[model samples]
Target: MKNIKIVSLTACLAWMLSLMLFSSCSNDDANAENSGGGPVIESVMPSGYNVDGSMKPLTPVTLVDPKNYYVIHGKGLLTTQKVYFNDFDTYFRPTFVTDTDIIILVDENTPFADASNQLKVVTANGTAIFDLTVAPPVPTFSGFNLINAVEGDEVTIKGKYFLDPVVTLAKTATEPEVPITIVSSSLEQIVVKIPANANHRNLAVTNISGTAVSKEAIGTALYDDKLYGMQWGGPWSGKGVNFDFDGDSYQGEKSWQWVFGGWDGGNWGFDVDMTPYKAMRIAVKGTKNGQVNFSVNGGSNYVIPVTTTWVYIEIPLSALGNPASVTMLTFQESNNDGGNTVLFDDIGFVLK
Candidate 1:
């Protein structure tokens, strides 16, 4: 019985030793899995000041700037596959990635939408998602093409971040506030019409990001009596000829389309005295490099060179013998089967 008791004590001690060994091995395996298995994001920091690889305090910003580099802190991030800021996929270099951190740059063309602001990091093991904020830059108003625009004129506002912009003309103490009609808009440009009673003190543009007011007041006019603006003359005749008041243009905020098919022609006729103007300027954009003939008052034809991009073709009024009373201005394309398309805008006289 004494021998049996000593054997039982030895067995109990062995079992306890075995249990401790098994627990230690299991803890080591769990640590390895946590370090090597899935990705984990702890914090994000700007790449400029993250020189020592230490996790900085997370930014409290609600929107992350585009085109800026940021560092992410985590574990199991060495084999990162992709990274996304909001809905935009950004670039991440494996060389810049490590087991506990990642470097990435947010794309510039990311669209602003009402989607999740979660930053996602994908890896072979799993994905790590963190709630983030990303937004576009605020709208900026640099200047406009036409500083002095009339009521019926389409003014082109040139700036950045013009997505879904709202343009308004400031009201005077006497005059009521007027909202300018936006004819068309793009990411960098916006075309708006000057209201009839607009006392253009300040031009304001608001977008999803923010609002920007012009630095200087735009000169508003009721009518430009000196300039005879012929925008998209629809009275002309030509095959495949089309005109749109809200098309792509390099001048006057809009363009007219003229499709040429074997000697197509168009003209605008008016009974007026154009002796005051020294030259006639026509902004033209063509499909290819070519030449078009223009005639004034049915007199000598002046050849104007056109190219694939928008160009101003200024013809001296003396080329047409400086007619005192002008009756017609005509344009004719060369005969060809290529069916070239041309865009024209701002056909008027300038004082040189």
Candidate 2:
């Protein structure tokens, strides 16, 4: 009876030890899973579908397009904290994250996106780096400054994707293209000198990606000089008159409130000879039917009729005594009775 009792006790002790060891091992495994070791990026893929709407396989891609969705294959992605394209933060969804996959959307407004294509992923455990080639969208042509420009004058073209641009000018669609000298080039702007004999026909820019042609002829000119392309003036407040760019055209807004003395003005003075040009052409639009006065050399006032729509007002230099040297050009609005607004653009000279 004594030997039987000892054997039973030993068996019970052994069983308890086995249970304790098993429990310990199970706890360790749970902790390991909760920690989610360091993140590892395997590959990046683009998401798209076929015509039938069937899901496409997550094939690896080297290039990424802005404003598009992509999938990242990796481990420990569930704990991802952030994703960056270049230095720009992008959007990602935690719900889309799995132990081995993550979904992200590249930001459309990523700065210098094509210039720097390094993608970085961060997690609590570790970070991963990937090299991506970014393909930017095709270029766009909005408009340019100095619509009527003379030879040797710098004309700035504004738009998008101006990388390694090639600028050309022609008198008409049928004329041969003439290359203009580029003074500077950037992603959104290019400054070039108007070549001699440029016919003011069509101005176009071609980059490696695409091309943009102006909708209208830049305006006729053989010898032209731009005084104010809406890039001047001082700080003042009244009924509120200001100069700004409206994407498609330069604008001048003027209010004839009593607080503003019922007038707003801007002036430019240069030593350019106005004898060669026939008239000063200005593109303007007003709130209602009114008249605005323009003065050159602080001399006679040239009254221009304003309509609700835009119209070109040509003031003959001959009307201002055909000044031998242009000292100043002034624009003033004082005819506002109850207050009025106006927009002006393409302030320059027209060749005879």
Candidate 3:
């Protein structure tokens, strides 16, 4: 009798537990099916660790960051079929969904410009909309310069993610950022009026995500309109290369335009110490995509592939045999794609 009673008790406990689980699932399913009312979003909260690693409580944000997860707090979300950030169709997992909350990751490809600026949720019963802004990733501050720039000359900044950008120039490291006038802006380029106060300081571009600072500053170019401390180099006007006399430029009036034949090349002469610099930088584009062998002091060639669009690249000095002095800055056509014209500007070096 004792053994029989024990078995009965065990069975009874198992039945109770199963009944409770069924009831819980049933309640959730019922809530999800009760779609007579539409979904609503009360607030959106960021997920995960903070940048500072502080224990400060997380708060709701009006901005949705790309590549980050966020929680949607509201009712009627258990049966949510879709969520859109900035009208972008974002993917979410159903197992993570619930009636009052949803954990979803914002896709990195979500549009940050020219969008509805909305966070929408569609459920079985209805849909809900929340006002939210999608922020672009941190801006990339490749380089900026103005050829023969005076106090009010237009300076062109090159990089990525210039959406709703704010441009500032700091005369020194300790000084506050001074706002500059913007002439025009695109996703990867910006033209701003150079302030008189600009000096050997830093330039920064800020967007919703964060700021990107320049690796160098104004009045620091190796070749801006003219070379600084440059001895002599290049096609030398009818010798091997020429300027864009027609006025197509990467920044200012014109850039170095080279139309090469097969195996054509040119060299720039410089008698200056390069120990203070970290890399060789330039903004270049080609009429036809091709490659060139760039060398310093006739070191091992650093092959640079050029595209049709203007692109700024910084090649570390170490890549070119780490020459301590600038003797020969050479460019030789190696594309073998017949020959093509390439435009160059913002020729310079970056500080260590």
Count of clashing pairs, candidate 2: 0
Candidate-wise lDDT, in order: 0.65, 0.63, 0.75
Q: Write one digit per residue (lDDT tens) for candidate 1, span 1-352.
A: 0001112334334433543454355444543677667888767654332335443343534456676556676667767998988767888667666666665666767666565878889999899998877666788886565656657878778888776788988555666657899999887889898877543456788876678876445542111222243433433453565554455765445566777765677776666556546766677778887877788878888877778988866668888778886677778876355556777765655542
What is the alpha-carbon lDDT of model 1 when measured against the actual structure?
A: 0.65
- When summed lDDT is taken over every stretch of 10 residues in candidate 2, the lowest stretch is 251-260
Worst 10 residues of 1 by lDDT: 1-10
Q: How are the candidates ranked when ordered by lDDT, highest leading?
A: 3, 1, 2
TM-score of each: 0.46, 0.49, 0.65
Task: Please list all clashing residue pairs in model 3, or write none if there are none.
Answer: 233-268, 235-241
Model 3, range 134-228, lDDT digits (tens) per residue?
Answer: 88889997667663355888888899999999999854546878998999999999999988867555688998788888876675576655456
Off by over 4 Å in 1: 1-61, 74-81, 87-89, 98-100, 108-111, 123-127, 136-164, 169-196, 199-281, 286-288, 292-304, 308-343, 346-352
Off by over 4 Å in 2: 1-43, 49-61, 74-76, 113-115, 133-140, 150-153, 160-180, 195-201, 206-211, 219-283, 287-343, 347-352
lDDT measured at residue 59 in model 1 versus the true structure, 0 to 100: 57
RMSD of each: 17.6, 18.8, 10.9
TM-score of 1: 0.46
